[model samples]
Target chain A: MTLTHEPSGSTAVTSPPVVRRRRALTPTRVLAGMVRVAVAVLIIGAALFPLAWMAIAGFKSKQEVVRTPFQFFPEVWRLENYRTILDDPAFVRTLAITGLGAVLFTLLSLTVNSFAAYAFARLDFHFKRALWVVVISTMFIPGMTILLTSFIVVTKLHMLDTLAVLILPGAAAAVHVFFIRQFYLNIPRSLEEAAMIDGCGKFEIFVKLFVPLSKPPFVVVGITSFLVFWNAYVWPVMTITSPDLYQVQQYLATFRSERSSELAMLMAGSTLAAAPVIVLFLIFQRQIIANIKMAGLK
Target chain B: MSTTVTSPPRSADGTPLRAHPPRDDRIAFLMLAPVLILLSIFVIVPTIYAIYLSFFNWSFYQDSEFVGLRNFTNALTDPEFRAAIRRGVLFVLMTLPIQLLLSFLIASFVTGVGKRLGTALKISVYIPTIISAVITSITFALIYEYSGGLLNAVVGLVGIEDQAWIGDVRLALPAIAVPAIWMGLGLMTLIMIAAMLDVPESFYEAAELEGANWWQRTLYITIPQMKNVLLYLLITGFVAAIQQYELPLVMTGGGPLDSTTLPNLFIFNHFRGDTYQGYSIAAALLLFLVLGAISALIFRVLSSEKLVD
Candidate 1:
């Protein structure tokens, strides 16, 4: 039944084990093991050191940041640097706007995306297959290509400089739709079939049955969309001309230019911008990896 | 379909339908309407409009004029646009193979090790991928700073002189590339690891029985099995490199004399400038076409009947 042939059990029994075991400990094997350990260290170090440096730099004083011998940790750890960023009214406004936008985008995107996913996965409809393909194909279209024209659309709708500009356009992502649909497809038909026989309508089945069953995929989509909106820079930068409407990432980008000499301040802003998503990743690392794997398989 | 809709057969209770197929279609359509409409307005319309704008003399102040193919011609001849495209291609060439190779190697190594160690390494590697691109850029910018930069501080311990990593004209692209590769390595590694794990244990066991060494098993058994995932990464990673904007925008500002000006940045610059909007739109569309063609070509080349598959 398997697609590829497996080595027969007789071959495993007949193989010379002791000779091969001795051969495996040759100098090349030892050298290879050493190389592997070295590479592992290098990989882990490369991944971790920049993050560690950023965290340490966030606490260092401006003087200590650029001082000779390059202070790895602050000589005098300053909480004031983070305080400076946190106290700024503009930073507060940016965080509020970004947070609200992310929440709205997540709620809206998850609701709509899951509805469409359930429809595509469970319900029979005209052009269901064709429409699903269309949705999936849009996932391949690069965001940058249509960005300018989309900005124009937003402006025409008078959404420019409004949080709606951020939330509405991103409210229906193809990737989330595809991810949720894949999850929905795996749910057994028997559950929905049984529900239908109990006099539940499609919408009822969707709300009571589908929604209750697919919480993990929904959370993955919610977190993903939230992260995108929270971390969004290019769209907000293009559309948000009003200083009051700046998102955190845009605010931080500008903050870097305005105070380029203040390394500690900049790192503090980076930490603020990066922390929540990092925490989210930590909590849902397994689900995030699964989501990515799902994306790849498509 | 029309027969079912127009004059449905009566059910046992003399109802028009039993399961209500037409009603189900209607409900499905209702469920699908929001996303479908939003996608149309945001994605489909803008795509068509971008193509339309490519053929016009249009901007905020300028009067609209339909000048077919002129914008495309101008983009082709524009030196700055050409340089941007060349730099983008260079970035892709420089980063993709390095990231893919490193990620694949790390993934293989991580899988070969014990489970707890593998999980620890995976978590550490994957941490950066979740961080925003802007934050990563700023972090690296500080790290790339010449005088008190972390990289220089480390290298100086070994007596290497401090060099302006992002400030130097030749080094800026690669400097930007360092963070780009680092940010992506985690996700790539994870994807590769997942793909590697999909190579069935039986294949490895069988290969071991035949006296195949580790390298041989990887080459003959693992890689061949992971071709689709590898190709998937190849195309998507290539497309991502083509659209790169945020890292270079924040880190180098496409700087040290435009060494890292990706095509997306070029388009953004043109969009900001009043006169060059047409050229930007035209180039953006062209870049889209080029990306599509390249992805298709990759799919075609790698999708030829593999000996094992």
Candidate 2:
């Protein structure tokens, strides 16, 4: 009754993920499909309820948001809230700072990670063994454990309250180096070899042969890093004191805490903060999802 | 794949194509120096400094006094520290199982349907994960409002009285955990769906031919085949849930008689301008060791354990 051997022996060499369909339309089969579709609707509903509720509440009038009987949709939509928030200079600045830091972090980390990953993936050096241990071992060392001391370290270096504290401390993450390195290893060496035979230097070879060929991983990791920076809360809270310097998540937290009673304001701010990441996720979702599934397959 | 990527470095069969002349070694060093120097300054130095600070009564203001293990001893006996550890464990207990079960059931259905519908379900379930937890908590806060909230509104239809979710001590922890659990569902479900879809349909066909009912077929085939993925998710979930800082910090503020004061918040309470900063560093180090041991044990099990049905 073992299936490990039976599956490989099947005559049908179907493509992946081909669920065997019931050939005849039995009543039980129809019922099962109906039940599954019903569950899908429910699962999607539960997953999206809170976010949809927030967006809906953002459009409600001040008095209508907390009305005793809940209205699923606002009676009179308040589009002015979005307009006012967008017109506010301070709010615009917060979005700008958040975007600036996220873009900087993504770009800087990609270079640092690709360089280090390239070294490990393609180079041979004297201390390659010991150096790799030095790099990768730090992956297990929890960032929380080092938070207090890292704060002290950054403060001594005079990085507190600056964008450097946000961008640089996270720039050379061991995990990214490892992830990109794993991707780098999968690429065929022949391309690089051909470039090498063309009398191209190592840097030239990497630029020509590797960078152009490695767009997918860069996109995947770049998007991931950007969202991570955008969503960062704890470190920015600890390091930055100025309201002007607050990142997107920090701004959302401050908005809700200082104005917890104003349901409309909080929802509007939360929705705004969630907007960019949401848009980005929708845009690159195909690649992101394919990467996630590929991660599982690996 | 392991998120930590702690697999040992490969044997020197690595660089056969590229010749490693002295000039190449210099180039390699130049490329690696950024990662190496940053690691030393940030990660390596801080880890060593944390251990160093655990011995001394370090403070931002006054001269730090050297006390031999007094901080550790104080943290060990501290009631708040014990409760924080327990709450951290409580989060893992409350969230991981329910998320796994929900993911399993949801994935089974999603993968069963047509492909386009399945993709739509996956995207809807996963969209929330991309949003920041701080925003998610705010969204949850409105939903968990004492009056006119969605939860209360729904329950009122069932003739149940409205509940103070984050305001009540008994409900605060679970309330704080809900948004976090919800945020995690997309990733877990996506991972689960991938794993479930990977299981060969022929196996189920064989079981059906053997007269195995749907439930029995799942038990004998699907569950056993998905064990490694399940275990992987469990370990990652444990690690992730225990680090639950943002949700509780945002939703409940660790309030209602400190009912939701998680371990990280507990550490923050001490380290952020408290006189007991030394004790906080020590406690953090202690938690690190415990988590480190657990992670190591997981790696051991992952590498060595044979699959059995």
Candidate 3:
């Protein structure tokens, strides 16, 4: 983290992946080889530094974090910070609330979005044009711009501080519908025709054929949706007034004010908020990259 | 493609296929009704509600008289609102170009490397993307602390003094942009990588055959070919930048004298205050119109960045 990842751009020369392994590692290539190694090292270190720093800071004592002549390594490696966060009912409840909200929002939103996507992509319907216009028109309105009014609307609907306020308002994204519809539209009509010939109804065809086939796009959209719902802060801040309803970010928002001097604990809370998503990302890395390739290349 | 619903097959084969069923309007409607209701409640109604409420001099749950376009005029003239908009634009300036450049370079470098190292770098860069903005802010808060923070420790290695990153006006906005850029870096890099790969290895090989250095190759060929994705990213990233609320809220709470207060955070603060609810809603609507216009322009310039054709 001492350096940004710019100088590593020296790998600038051989950046196309296909050509990366094609070069020979011979004596003639010493300078180029050294540069490549430098690039690799810098990219890894620079990218991981902030996260690594946060993780490490969790191990330091409160005083050690702000200790004079700042030490890079903590004097003591503490596990108590993690334990402390997990033990706090407020913190743990934030995790549970956020986890449940994200999963349910993902499933609910994807189902509805895919339903809408299928309708636009494969089926002909009355009001299709009008409905598509309605969804697509609001596609780019930044949620921040609507925060107060969304509060007013949800309050008017009597949903403020309820769990439904968290999940339902954001469950039907126009962008998701658009993304999934783009995917659905790309599936060959012959597959749908064959399914139709087998006497399957439109709904059945969507469930069996389209749903299964759309996995790659679903993975991409699903992971993103989960992250969006999990990381959601602005709306939750406006609506969830009760401490019990705090999402992960909601808790993080209050961290400085609630436990001001506990740097280690703050770091622990940040790590807890971040770690699960990192694990999810690592497990899904190959799929995320692969599906993106499929989406882009196909 | 819509013709698939009614028109006959494009190719004739020996395969026997029955005629397609009539249009599935009822089935489609059944499927779409739930989301439509949700969308109407959340997206549509809030938007229209915001517009309607913008005209009134109403406070929280208060029955008040309509004030015509006074709120709009007042918001436009309000020094804080104007300053916040300026800061939002300033942030976009500070963040976007660096993000575009760094992500582009990192994207090229990471994707170019061997499998083991590439995977390592890829995961590391993208880690920040998944972390919530609030958590990112919380992490960076400690890092940007005036005394004995991580950033100062790093800077001290080069003999710079300990700096009040988010506390000082000059550094506060830039300080917030750091985490913003870091969080967005991975996704943009991933996007850039995909676009770079789509440029075809033939283009790079041809440049290499002509004795162009890698820097020149990237500058002349790689950058040019990826313009559409870059432009798409720039525009969308701009919109995202302007909407930044979390960092300022969690980090500096609008910073020393509102230097870091972005337009959204400005609205959010007014939203908390009991008196200016109507004006906040009006300001929100105006911002909405501007963003909606930019988004429309983006959609028109490039199809919707599935980066669609």
Chain B TM-score, all predictions listed: 0.87, 0.88, 0.88
Provide the lDDT at B236 for model 3. Answer: 77
Docking class of 3: acceptable
What pairs collide in candidate 2?
A: none
Q: Which ten residues in a row have the lowest lDDT in candidate 3 chain A?
A: A1-10
As a whole number from 0 to 100, the lDDT of residue A284 in candidate 3 is 78
Clash pairs, candidate 1, are none
> Candidate 1, A143: how far from true, in Å?
1.7
Q: Using TM-score as the measure, name the better of candidate 2 and candidate 3.
A: 2
A1-298: candidate 3 lDDT, tens digit per residue: 0000111221332234644346676787888778988987887787778888898998888888888888888877988888887899889888998899899988988899899989988886566666787888877777867777787788888998988998998888877787778777677899889988999999999999999987765776778788888888878877888988888887877777877998888888888888888888888776565444222221
DockQ of 1: 0.37
* Deviation from native of the Cα of residue A296 in model 3, angstroms: 8.6
Question: In DockQ terms, which candidate is top?
Answer: 2
What's the DockQ of model 3? 0.43
In candidate 1, how many Å is residue B245 off? 1.2
Q: What is the TM-score of chain B in candidate 2?
A: 0.88
Question: Higher lDDT: candidate 2 or 3?
Answer: 3
Q: A150-240, model 2: which lDDT tens digit per residue?
A: 9999999999899999998888887677667766777778888888888998878777877886666687778888988999999999899
- How much does candidate 2 score in TM-score? 0.91
Q: Model 2 lDDT vs. the true structure? A: 0.79
Tens digits of per-residue lDDT, candidate 1, A119-210, equal 87777666666687677667656777898899889888999888788888879877777667766776778988888899999899999988
From the highest DockQ down, the ranking of the candidates is: 2, 3, 1
